[model samples]
Target: MLERWSRGLKGLGNWTAGVMDAFYGALGTPGKYLQDFLNGSWLGHPLHPVLTDVVVGGFTMLIILDLVSLIFGANFRDPSLIILGLTTLAGIATILSGLTDFKDTATGDERNVTTLHGYTNVASILIYAIAFFVRLGGSETTGQILAIIGYLVISVGAFIGGHVVFKYGYMVNHNAFSRGRRAKEFTPIMPAVELAENTPTKAALGPTALVLVRRGDVVYALKETCSHAGGPLSEGQLQGGAIVCPWHASHFRLSDGAVVHGPAHTRQVAYRARIQAGQVEVEGPVG
Candidate 1:
C-alpha cells in the first residue's frame, strides 16, 4: 500500500545523491560544522522537526484565518499574510536543515523515503511562496486558494516524513531502547591483557555489546553501537580522545561518550571500565 508508493519514490534518492555529494564535497569541513548545527548537535536534538512544527502550525493558522475571512466576512488578511511570510521563512530553514540531515542517510529505503519527503516539502514551499506573492498583489481569493492547496501538499509531505522517522527509524537514537537496561554493577567483559592501548575492541556485558579502548592503565568503554546510525564503534578509528563512527564520522569523546561532532545529536552510552584482577570489568552509562 503505502510501502509501494514510497518505493516508487526511490528513484528520487538516486537522482539527488550525486548532486548533493558534489555540493557538500565543495564545502568540506565547514559544511560538516554547518551540518552539525543544522542537525542540532549543540542542542542534543534534531533541528528539522522544530522548524517543521513552526511551518505546519503557521500554515494551519493561515488556513483557519482564510476560512474565517471567507465564511464570516472578517478582515483577517494582515494576520494571514504575516503568518504566510513567517511560515515561508520557516519552510526555507526546514529545507536547509532537512537536507543537512539527509546528507548522511544510507542508500535503500531510508534514502528513498527521505528523498520523497524532502521534495514534497520543497513543492509545498514553492506553492506557498507563490501564494505569498499573490496575496501581496491584492488577490486575496486566489492567494487563499493557493495557500489551501499548499497546505494539502505539505500535509502529504508531513505524512511521508513521519513514515521516514516512525516507520524507518531515520534520525532515531539507536540507543533509545537500551537506556533503561544499562549495567547496574561492574560486569567482567574480557581479559585486561586482551585490550590493547588506543585500540577499539569489542566486548559484551550480558546482552549489551561494548567498545573498549585502553589508554595506559585506564580502560574506556562505550556502547558498541554508534548512537547516530548503529555503526559498530569497535570498527571506528580513535582521533585523540574521541572515537569516530565509521558510518558517518560522528566523533564521540572516549572520556564520557559526549558527541564531539555529529550528524548524531544523541550521546553514545558510556561505561566505567577497570581491571579487577586480570579481567576487564565494565559498568554504566556514565554519560
Candidate 2:
C-alpha cells in the first residue's frame, strides 16, 4: 500500500508538472524576467533555493522559540508575533521566487518535478498563512495550535524541496559530476595528427567528452561542451586556438578550455593528447 501510494504521488506530481510546464511556457517574457530573478543572476546563485532555505529556516526557528518559551515559562507573545509576521513575508517571497525559477525550466521531468514541488509548496504556504492569521487573531492557547500546525506544513514543504534538489540535482553545475575521480590524471593516448587540423574529434575519457583540435603539429583536447549551457564547443568557430560557442559566442582556449568571454565563467575541461598505435586517443576530464 505504501509503495502504491508513493507511486501514485509521483504520478500526480508528473501530471501537475505537465500542466504547469504548459502554463509557464506560455507566459513568455513575464516568465523570463521571473526566471532570471529565481536563478539569482543578481546574487550569483540560485535565489529560489536560497530563499527556500530562508523561509523554511524561519519556521524552524519558530519551533525553537516554542521550545524556549515552554522551558523558560517566559512570555514569547511579542517575539513570536514578530517571527510569525516575518515568516509570512518570507513564505510569500519563496512562492514568488519559485515561480521565476519554474519559468526557465525545460519542459520535461524537471518541469514535472518542479510542478509537484510547486503544488506542495503552495499548499503548505496556504496552510502556514492561515496558521499565521489564526495566531494573530486568537489568544495564547490558539497561538500554540497555530504554531504547531504551521510547523507541520513547513516541514512537509521542506522535505519535498529537498527531494526536488537532491534527487533531481537542480541548480547544480551540470558538469560538476561529469568529472570522474581520474580527471587530474592527464596522459595522451593518441597522436595529434589523428584529429583533422581544424576539425575536432571526440573521445570519451572516463565520462567526460573530449574534443580535439590540431594546429600544424601541436594537438590539444578540451571539453566538448560549452560550460555555460552545454553547447557543443567543438562545433564552434576557432579563433587563435580558442573555440567560440556557436550558440552564445562563449569562447574557450583549445590548449585548455578556459573561458574567454562572459556568460560562462567556468572553464572547460582540457586534456592531454597523444597517439597509440594507429588509433589517436586523448585523456580528458575525469567522469
Candidate 3:
C-alpha cells in the first residue's frame, strides 16, 4: 500500500525538477562549498539526519509535556514553548540541508521518491508552524491538539524519509562497500588501444564494472557507478583529468578517484591500469 502511494508521488516530480534545477544551478563555487558544509561532507555523513533527531526529540518532549499538563493539571507551558521554538529552528536547518542534497538527485524514479519525501516534510513543517502560533496565543487546548497533529504528520514524513535511505539509497556512497576488497592481482579486461584518450570506456573485471579513461600511456580506472546516486560513469564526460557523472555532474579525479566536486562526499574506487601484452590490465587499488 505504501509502495503504491510512494510511486504515485512521481506525478509531481516534473514540476519539482523544473523549479529546483534553477535554484541548484545558481549556487556557484562558494554556494557549493556552503552546500557541502551543510550536508556534512566534513563529518563524513549527512547532517540532515543528525539535525532531524533534535527536531523529533523536541516535538516528542513537547507532546509529553502537553500530556502531563493535561493529566496532572500542571503548568508545563514554559518548557513546551521553549522546545517548540528550538524544534522550529532545527527543522528549518534540516530543510535547508535536505534541499541542498535533493537538488543533486538524478532524475527518474529516485527523483520522484525524493520529491515525495521532501514535500511531505514540508507539510509537517507547516503543521508545526501553525502549532507554534497557536501555542504563542496562550490557547493551551488548541495548541496541544495542533502539536499532537504536527507530530503525527512528521512521523509520517519520518517513515518516508527512512524509505528514501533504506529503499532508494539517498546520500549514500554507492561504492563504499567494495573499495579495498577487490583481489590484489592484475586482470586484463580489454586491449589498451580500445580505450581512447580523454573518453570514458566501460570494462568489467571479475564482478566489478569500471570506467577507464586513457591519457597517453596511462589508463585511469574508477568504479563505473557514480558515488552519488549511482549514476553511470562510463556515460559521463572526462574533463581536466576528472570524470563527470552525467546525471548530477559529480566530478572525480581519474588519478585517485578523489571527489573534485560534489554532492558526492566519498571518493570513488581508483585502480591503475598498465598495458600487459598489448592489453589493458588493472591491478587492485590505486595509491
Candidate 4:
C-alpha cells in the first residue's frame, strides 16, 4: 500500500514539477536566501522538524481541551480556539520551511515521499483551519468534531514525516558512519607535487575516497562524497575558501569541512593530510 501510494505521489509530482519550479524560480535570489535561512544553514540542523513540534504540540493541547469539555461539560471553547489560532500561525511558518526543503528534492522516490508528506500535512492544516473558524462562530460541537478529525489526519501526517526521515534518510548526513580508516597511521596515496594548487584531486586512501586540495605549503583533505546526498565533492568547484557540491550546491569549508552553506546541516568528513617523503599521505580524521 505504501509503495502504491508512493507511486501515485510520484505521478502527481511529475505532473506538477514544472509549475512548482517556475513558481519557486520566480522568487529568485530572495527565495533562495529564504530557503537557506529556513533550512537552518547557520543552526546546523533542519528547522522545519523543530518548528513542527510547536504546531503539533498546540493542536495536541486542543485535543486535550476537547476531552476536558466533553468530560466536565465545561465550556473550554475560548482556550481551545486561542490554542488553535496560535498553532495555525505556527503551522504556516512550518509549511514555509518544509516547502523550502521540498524544493531541493530531486525527481525520484525521495521527491515522491516528500511530496506525499507535504500534501498530508497541508490537508491536516486545512482541517484545523476549518475547525478554528467553526469554533469562532460558537459551534462548539461541530468544532470539536472537526478538531478530532484534524488531529487524526495530522497523526498520519506525522507518521509519514517520520518515514521521510528514517525510511528514506532525508536530510541526514550521507557519511555519518564514515570515519576515515580503522588504522590511525597516515597512508600515502600519491605524490604531493602532483596535486595542483587550488584544484580538487581525487585520491583513495585504503577504504576512503578523498578530495585533496593543495595551497602552497598546506594541503587539505576531505571525504570525496558529499555529506549531503553523497554528491561527489571531487567534481565540485572550489570557490573562495569553500567547496560547493555540484549536486545540491551545498558548501563546506576547505579548512575544517564545516558547513558554510546548506541544504546540508552536517559537516563533511575532514581528514588530515601530511607530506611524507614528497607523497601526500592521508591520516585519520581531523582532530
TM-score of each: 0.94, 0.59, 0.85, 0.92
Give residue 42's lDDT in candidate 2 (0 to 100): 45
Inter-residue clash pairs, candidate 1: none
Overlapping backbone residue pairs in candidate 3 total: 0
Q: What's the lDDT for all of these models?
A: 0.88, 0.64, 0.81, 0.83
Best by TM-score: 1
Clashing pairs in 4: none
Q: What's the TM for model 4?
A: 0.92
Please provide, for model 3 over 1-287, each residue's C-alpha lDDT reduced to its tens digit, 9 standing for 90 to 100: 45556577766766666655676568767776776677676566788899989989889999888888889999988888889888988898888888878877666667777777788888888888888888899887888888888888889888888887887678988876766437588888898778787789998987788999888888888989888778899999877979988987878888889877777878888887877788888988765
Per-residue accuracy of model 1 over 1-287 as CA lDDT, tens digit each: 45656678777777676666677779998877887899899888899999999999999999999888889999998988999998999999999889888878888878877888899999999999999999999999899999989999999999999988998788889999885247779878788888888899998887888899998889998899999988999999999999999988999999899989988999989888888898898877775
Q: Candidate 1: where are CA atoms >4 Å away? A: none
Candidate 2 regions with alpha-carbon error over 4 angstroms: 1-34, 42-45, 70-72, 104-110, 180-207, 210-222, 225-287
What order do you get sorting by TM-score, best first? 1, 4, 3, 2
In lDDT terms, how accurate is model 3? 0.81
Ranking of all candidate structures by their lDDT, best first: 1, 4, 3, 2
Question: Candidate 4 residues 97-147, lDDT tens each?
Answer: 887677667778878878888888889899889988998998888988998
